[model samples]
Target: MIEVIGLTKRYGGKTAVDDLSFTVRPGHVTGFLGPNGAGKTTTLRVILGLDAPTAGAVTVDGVPFRTHRRGLHHVGALLDAQQVHGGRSAQAHLAALARSNGIGRRRVGEVLAEVGLADAGHRRIGGFSLGMKQRLGIAAALLGDPPVLMFDEPINGMDPEGVRWVRHLFRSLAAQGRTVFLSSHLMTEMEHTADHLVVIGQGRLIAAEPLRAFADRGTRQRVTVRTPQPAVLAAALTAAGASVDTAPDHLAVRGLSAEQIGALAFANAVELHELATHTTSLEEAFMEITAGHADHLAGSR
Candidate 1:
């Protein structure tokens, strides 16, 4: 498990993280989300001991990451897939990290195959495409077979197949009782992959909860209704304190539950064909909750 408590970091006069606190437990894929310039990179750097926190602390498995002699065996991370030396082959790069962590060379080959880079291990990293580099980085992170893994945009340049593979890999790791902390800007993939979420905005904690709970925080609860008598149902729904948006075939309703709508329709003798609730998507909830915290907002052209 990873625990970040009262964490704060400042660069010169600017505060990047402000008293942030969150726990990433084992056996779950926890997603980290934030708008641009929200200090997510800073927090990840501090957690990996790459940058010192101005205040508070971070610990992986009950101890600071830097205190471990074999850091990879305790906590493995891929902050930037392109940070490796382009001169080295994928096998060579992982071999070096394994050696530093007192891991055998055989583990390097295992991880390379695990990441679907067995055929490309002999090629130089500089010649690899962005997607291939991402695979190689994942290979390195798994080299030590650590119980804790942290990845930042691990699917940045992956193809559709690669993206699916990563989703399965993260879920598999969490299933094995490992602490998996993933940071990505892709909300759709995150909604599929993550079981829980830790959201931050402007370097402050906005939410830390299960994915469904967070998404349900969105205010736009809607119900879709399909009926043969669309006009009758629409009028009945509107008169019962619900806003109705009419369509050619169906009506989109707000401010009423499916049960309540069904009951009202029955009372008004309105025949119904379909009634379904549509909760907010992860993207919608993210936008709604962090609408005010975005540092960079785009204007319509």
Candidate 2:
């Protein structure tokens, strides 16, 4: 579990994090989200103790990370895959990390195998592609055999197969009872990956709740009805108090059930070509929520 209490940081006059507070519990994946320069990286730095907070504190499992017994073994993170020394072999790189942290060589092999890099362990990192670096970074994180894991944009710079693999990997890690904290710019990927979301904007917390709740709040269930008498159906749907919009061959409608639309058509002796319910996609919901916040902030600005 990671608990952040009134975590704040300031660089001279600019406040990066303004008295932020949140609890990241284990047994689930928590997503950290924000736009560029929205203090996400700074917050992660504070949490990992790489940068000191101006006020408040962050703890891993009831204690600051520096104070934890086997601190590196308790929390593993892959913030940047490119942070590796380019000249070293993948195996040599992980070996050095294992040695520095007093992690055993056997565990090194396990992690390398775990991330499917066992064969490439002898390969130099400079020669590896972005996808390979991602795998190596993951191997480094798991070297500690930690129960808590944190990743910042773990899926960036990967092919379609790599993206799907990472998604499956995160899900697999969560299922094994690890506390996974992920920060990704891919809203749709996050929607499918994270069990909970902690959204921030302008260095302030915007919303923190179950992923579904955030998505649901931005979408209204709508029904689409198509009819040959499109012009006729629009007026009838409006008279019926359903919000109606004109589609080329259909009436995109809201606040009406499929049965009601069918009944309305039947009563009016109207013929229909198509009738369907359209569920809002996750991307749309994210746009609606974040766009609303942006507009609100701009209005004030």
Candidate 3:
């Protein structure tokens, strides 16, 4: 489990992370989300001890990472996949990390295969494509077989196949009861992969909850009804306290469920062509929540 309490980081006069507190529990995949320059990467760095916090604390399994005797054995992370030395072979790279952390060389091969890079382990890091590098980074993260795993944008450069593999891998790890903390800008994949979410904007915590709860927080659930009698249905729905909007051939309804709308149509002996509920997608919800905190905004005078 990873616990962050009142975490804050500042560079010179600028504050990157601001009084952030959240728990990444075991047996779940928790996604960390934020807009650009919202301090997601900075928070990850502080948690991994790559950067020092100006205030507050972050810990993995009840202990600070830097103080752990075998930190890598307790926590595995891939904050920057492309930071490895280009001069070394993939195997050599893992070998060096393993040696530093007192891990055996055999475990290197194990993780290489686990990340689907067994065949490319002998190749130099410089020659690997961005996607291949991502795989190699994940291999290193799994090298220690740690109970806690953290990744930042693991699918950034991956192909469709690689992306699918990563989604399955994270879920598989969580199923095995590990704590998986991930940060990604890809909302669609995150919606499928993360069971919970910790969303931040402008370096402040906006939300921390289950994925379903977070998505449902926004006011975007609307019922769409298609019928030949659009005018009749719209009037009936409007009179029944539903905000109605007419579409090309459908009525977008607010403040009512599809069941309620269908019942109203049926009560009036109206023929219904289709009825469905359209909840906002994760991306849509995210944009709505972070709109006020966006670092850059556009406006026309």
Candidate 4:
């Protein structure tokens, strides 16, 4: 239950986030995706109040974060994995945090176990590996048992086993009616973990909808049309307002449907042809939507 409206942030002459708006609903895992410099981190900063927005507003559960007396009880976040003190043990670290927040000591152990870090609770955080630290940060976030959770690249340093564990963890949390908002550049993880997706680019919102909805706009339908005069068939189809690109052995049509192109060929006194249709992939769909930003990102180098 979070809403960001017209969220704009700037640094010097560069706009980190420009008029971004979106809503995170309960009972679902919403994936926030974008290219490297697409203002994802800045948006999170504005939402968390880590950085004030130049223009716009963000609210948690319909109230501004500053007004909630016990705001953290309803919202938990893991902004960075390395914020823990290096020399302190995991238990001590969580205990210290719980004390400041007036949370019980028992919650420390509960979150430790929940994050699969119970046995490592007494170990020094400095000695812990990257993945272990990530788990520890997650344990801290869950210590409050909040209804809303925000994680920025939770799987960044995780191994395959840890990644799979987090996948199930987010799903289970959302299934229990929690709002899980995650921002990551990892497309594969988003494909598996996110029921809804909010994608942005160039500091602006791009598409926000069910993952399947964005994927259904793909243009990669494969069509195979066979004709006696292949060259003439290709030319006629191109003239009939179809994007005719030559394959190694066949023709690829982009705009016009195979049926329409075939009919045009027939009208032009062309011979009959065989046609077959194929489907594209979710990854392809993502690329198509972010193509302009992807190209710009590439050109920046």
Which candidate achieves the best TM-score against the true structure? 3
Looking at model 3, the pairs that clash are none
lDDT of 3: 0.90
Give the range of the ten consecutive residues with the poorest summed lDDT in model 1.
292-301
lDDT of 2 by residue, 143-214 (tens): 888888999888888888888888888888888888898998898899878999888776778788888888
| Per-residue C-alpha lDDT of model 1 across residues 202-281, encoded as one tens digit per residue | 78899999998899886588999999998988888889999999988899999999999999999999988999999888
Q: List CA RMSD, all candidates.
A: 3.2, 2.8, 3.1, 3.7
Per-residue error for 40 in candidate 3, Å, reads: 0.6
Off by over 4 Å in 2: 295-301
Off by over 4 Å in 3: 296-301
Judge candidate 2 against the unseen true structure and give its global Cα lDDT, from 0 to 1: 0.83
lDDT of 3 at 131: 94
Candidate with more favorable, higher lDDT: 1 or 4: 1
Task: Give me candidate 4's TM-score against the actual structure.
Answer: 0.84
User: What is the per-residue lDDT of model 3 for residues 34-58, given as tens digits with 9 covering 90 to 100?
Assistant: 8888888889888899899999999
Model 3 Cα RMSD, Å? 3.1
Worst 10 residues of 2 by lDDT: 292-301
Which candidate number has the best lDDT? 1
